[model samples]
Target: METSQITDLKRILANSLEGIEDPIERSRSDFCFYLENVVHDEGPHALTDYIQLADFHREIADTLMDDKTSFLLVEAFRGSGKSSLASVAWPAYLASLNPSLRFALISKTDDQAITQLTGIEAILRSAEHQRIFGDLVPHRQYYNFRAPWSEQEKVIVRPKFSRFPTFLAAGVESSLVVGKRFDCLVADDVIDLTSSFSPTTRNRIKHWFYQVLLPTRDQRWSKVVVIGTPWVADDLYDSIAKEMAGKSFFKHIRIPAIQTEQTDHGPIYKSAWPEVFPLTNLNRIKSEGHFAFQNQYMLERYDVTQSILKKEWLKLIQQDYIPKELTILQGIDPNAGRVTGKTGDMLALATVGIDADRQAYLLDLVYIKGDIQEQLLHITDHITRWNPKDIASEIEATQAHFKNYLEAKLKETLGLDITIRGITSKNVPKPIRLRAMFDAFIAGKVLVAAHVNWETGDLEPLPSLLPFVEEWISYSANAPHDDALDAVDIALSSVLEYGGRLAALTIPSEAIIIKDRENLEKEEEMSEEDLELADLLEKYEKNMTGTSVLANPSRFFQRRINFRGLNL
Candidate 1:
């Protein structure tokens, strides 16, 4: 942890010094150097801007310079300066250097594209900008400046001495320059909120993009660059990603707000800009607002309408306690794979215990994929280790093999006889079954036994248990992984008679503790003498060490008290 902190500090110091090192020369050469030193977009001596973003800007600059570049998709967070850096500084700098780089700036609406173009014009007019570009900078003599923001004022100053290309801004609905071809097409804010959420609007934007925008690309000069905050998982950006997956010219950079660090135990997500987005601040945002955090910062999307389980409904048991007098049950979802690989799904199994209050406390869960024999070996190991009182499995043709194999293995190797009851889990669809399980959670009938330590952002010492909560938080109808949810549903069956099977049967009398079911109600009605007698019995029980008690030496006094209670 100390090494990590020191490394972060060194990086910060290095970025702060980046501007000071040959500022004039580097500013002319590097995009990041120019932004930090000349324009001071982060304010005077901010010292600690997110320099992590600079590498991506450098990538864009390099790609623009390369001859073979075809497409670049950049998904960054809300305040990462995707527009200010790429849309403004990059184009102005490139135009100043060569002046022949024709560029078309675009957005979801005409007004937005104009806004980006205006930023470029404003930069071109800056004192430092004019000094650097000198005769090359755009001037009043080059093009007509118009009132407010419009298509007429959209193009940057035309090539003054050279027959090179210039910059133009247009909405997705607008046409590119009629007789002119754009060498580089840069798009920002391509999808608005309303259009992103509605299928009809997204489709409209898709149709408009192919019809109007694709034609603007000059296949010979530079690649198309689209930069924006991704609102939906399956938005237009996803379509491009799919089409470009196998192509050689396609490249994209997805910068998330929080970056995950892998630890020996598990992975922990820390803010990329901890100064601006500390974990405390992010935790509050995540706890109070789910969808916003996910869409804005995480660059992931979920249709909440299709969700059966709400993350906030999950309950965690405190005080590090599991109910002593409860029934233990197990549920299994076998993957029946030949190997542990990314190609196929895995096995999901869960153990649950039901208390007197009918609350189901999730005890343990296992999700893994491997060879069929290897998986059976894994399950056999779990059975020997857990020794759960009752086990449940869905009666599917695929699962029957797993069920028989598990039973057969346990008896053959471990010499333990276990029942594999046919648990019919497919009577309801997955969503419906998951919803049924979610109902139990929402009704406060389900609790997880996790240690109370949200400071480190998890229930430590219960490393195996933390993924259950994370799975709940990231669960969606179109989720890529369903092993966790399936396991949870199987565990929840311990509360219902799903498929003619009891959630859990009574524990045998020999295994039962606190056998008296009506003792609590009887306490209030019992007479003083009867209560005194019960008190003596409780004391005697407390004195026992194991099944035997060494004389308490104060037993004579206890015997006298017992005698007094008998006389009463």
Candidate 2:
């Protein structure tokens, strides 16, 4: 406030640095420079804001500084400055309180740690902050900071400290075995949720944290901070939730991207909830735009159903279709009248088509309420007008009834060319097919018709399709049944496989060589007198075959590229 108080405060900061050991003297000096000058609106360098660091961020830093908690978890959305808050703000704050304090900045991988280290360097290097504390440069060899010191004052002779602080980079898994213990361990992005979604990756990270990170404390006062974005239903978030179920050692603070249904509609607290962080006025726009409220704020799972896939690709499929020339395909999921009540699943029959370019388009859905004959007759009549190329039916169950009808009655009665084939739910996993379909849409191979019906059951199932695939892949062995996904499974596989959509487009290297060899052999077998004429004929044949193969490499890859302007 006053000139006298400012001078006294400066005197106390200098004295505090001198009192610390020579090994920690620089840390205390830089810490004092940051707090006295940088934190306050003093000197050329000062942090203009602390609230941007998030509410729990400063609270966790304070706890670590006060030695109230040895473990802290602050999870936030991406681009939320979790790195700066932990690696820069907390470390600097702790260093000011206890010069002997040492911290190791850790991440899921070395690259991530180095990226965080770069941010730590940049925040300190800014002209405003650098003027007060001088440059704090990091040594690549040791991954430590060469301390900042003032040479102007004689008594201000800050003792020569370890030119570097104990700041090092190590991956979550490998860093577990390093012998050097730290006063504070910052496990930023420790549980990479995307990786944790895989059981193998989750186990590796879990083992690394439990075996390597947990043992890094040489003193009881050491602290460990786990921070990252919540990407899935499990992993670090579950671990923390389980451990801190009714305890206090593990504190979970979530800084959501936007206002959730809970916050918008649920009761409000007079004081902010320690566990729940509402976005400040400044971050409202960015938070709302970057992440979905249900996912970011409520921490609830976001469902990307099959309906989304059907809706998005419907246009593509529809546009590729020649309405007049379109040939229909009927796919069946027989219910068999097994259920005694209304709760049982209904039998579903889906008819699809492929236009000239080989895009599989869902044409119609036939939902029945009666026996096999009635349902069959209904589907036949519906597809009768278009004269479908083939009726792709699943013949695993109730094959006899379908065979009797096709062989004895339905084939002749409806003049239908029925081809019932069995499809295996093996080999390529459900997710793989869904991923392939996603790749197709992303690459523009798969699209639905414009005038196509969306109000039917075919389009209604799109929203849940991918989510079903995700679950089908995730819990295939344990889940009840994949009937809904099987419908999609059959549709996609039949389109890609039977339609020869992917196969036709991808040119085989073997075909080119075989055609060339055949032409050469024919040339050799010619008589000497006719050899000249034969040679000319052989050249013409080779050129024609080669040109044909080159002209149309693979119908699948080419049509997709033509439609989307991108190759898959």
Candidate 3:
């Protein structure tokens, strides 16, 4: 339909097709050869530098040239040459190689398929391509480019090769289930956060691939190549994991932003991929290696033995003595009132404190039941007894009645000012701070109190707590409700925001040391030293200094204390 297509046809009419029966076949084959060898040849780039991943393009060209392998599974980032090499140029060149190569270029949808074909079709129709390629192939259904390559000058250009090298954008489906037939099946950008997480949508894509795509691939050289940035584990990642189990027809190649190398120095040495990634100033691959390592380079699917959070890190935090000070922060599940009665999750109130050296000490937990008012009263009583500096409460979607009642009661009964800050979140639907906390835990940077129960005692509630955290770590951008894990959510959020300081229920007696045992025994005796210290405390409190600077000894001055004490 465009001028480029017309020019391509005219140029082919002028060029001489080296003896072939089908005009289409001769036309396609020559055009393919020209584009690969001359037009878009990525030559002279060093192989070691990832910049020359044009090797991947050349590899695809060779695979398309052969009749043996039809399926391909490619994993690369956005600029890793997926569209230019795989979708547009590759498929178009394949069709040009043999006009009769009845190939289907599929996409996430029909629209995407058409969209992919547009650029390639334009190139073919362009005057430069026509003059250089020497022939114009008719565009078929906005997908196929038909030409007569094997005949004389006057004959109608017809395809000589069989229908093949089809491009299909498949979601998540395995051929074992669906029965489709094709020479080649290429799936690009299959699953995203918006599509794969939905039960209905995911199932529908599964059916489409199994029932429609696989059954279509019934050829001697049948093959499937999947390519895309992995958004989650459910779609293609799950399939790849399953296929890895026994014998697999699929050959996998994972190319993260950073090329991997091994060295005795640090465990993972940097590889040569940086050469290619570094050339682009907008997003240097080397600079973003850490992000790529977490999001793409390492597969987070089945690395079970390496729990992100090491258990040993939690073991060092054992508090043998009664917590001298404690602060309880309660996170009520946003949906506490919408209970179905079958299974009701409660508001988890976990009390944490700072020891003499600013190390976080977990004291206890109160799992409460009942309506908002009842929970509010319990929280109030707990706070009064502890006299914490402040209760870090999550205000997002909290029950209005409970919040209002608590605030009013605090002002009226205790005359205490309660600060409740809502955790900010966007509509994009992902847990942010919770994931960061998990990362800290996994990296062995966080210490949990050793006194905390892990089995059935105080730690009993935590087994239930861990799965949700794991789910948060393993989740995609737009996931379902995390309302049930409100306690951990609030705690992690507050710690991240407020720099790990929590208000205690009572002035922790342990932080204050009496001058001596005799001073403790003396009744109503106010020494000058005590009065001076008391005056200093009054002045500090009046200045609104919320921090306990001298309150912490040892490693407290630093952002975090090295509580492990070199025991590791």
Q: Which number leads on lDDT?
A: 1
Q: How do the candidates rank by lDDT, highest first?
A: 1, 2, 3
Clashes of each: 1, 29, 76
Please provide TM-scores, in order, for all candidate models, with all chains considered together.
0.50, 0.47, 0.51
Winner on lDDT between 2 and 3 is 2
Could you say which candidate leads in TM-score?
3
Task: Give lDDT tens digits, candidate 3, residues 1-568.
Answer: 8999999987897575535456334445543444443344234652222213445555555554555444456666556666666666665555444433333455565456556566466555645456645464544543234332221111112444332222333223433223333555556666665565455676777667656766776555555666666644566546654555344454455555544556777556343245444435323332223223455543333222223333332313324333564433444333335233333345555455544433344444445556656666666676766655445444444344445556677888778777655444543233333544444333323334333331211222244344444444444444343443445555555453434532222222222222232344465765555445444544443464554424532112121122222221
Off by over 4 Å in 1: 1-25, 42-66, 135-165, 176-180, 303-308, 311-568
145-221, model 1: which lDDT tens digit per residue?
42122443434444443232476777776755455577777888888555666666788777776666777667666
lDDT of 2 at 515: 49
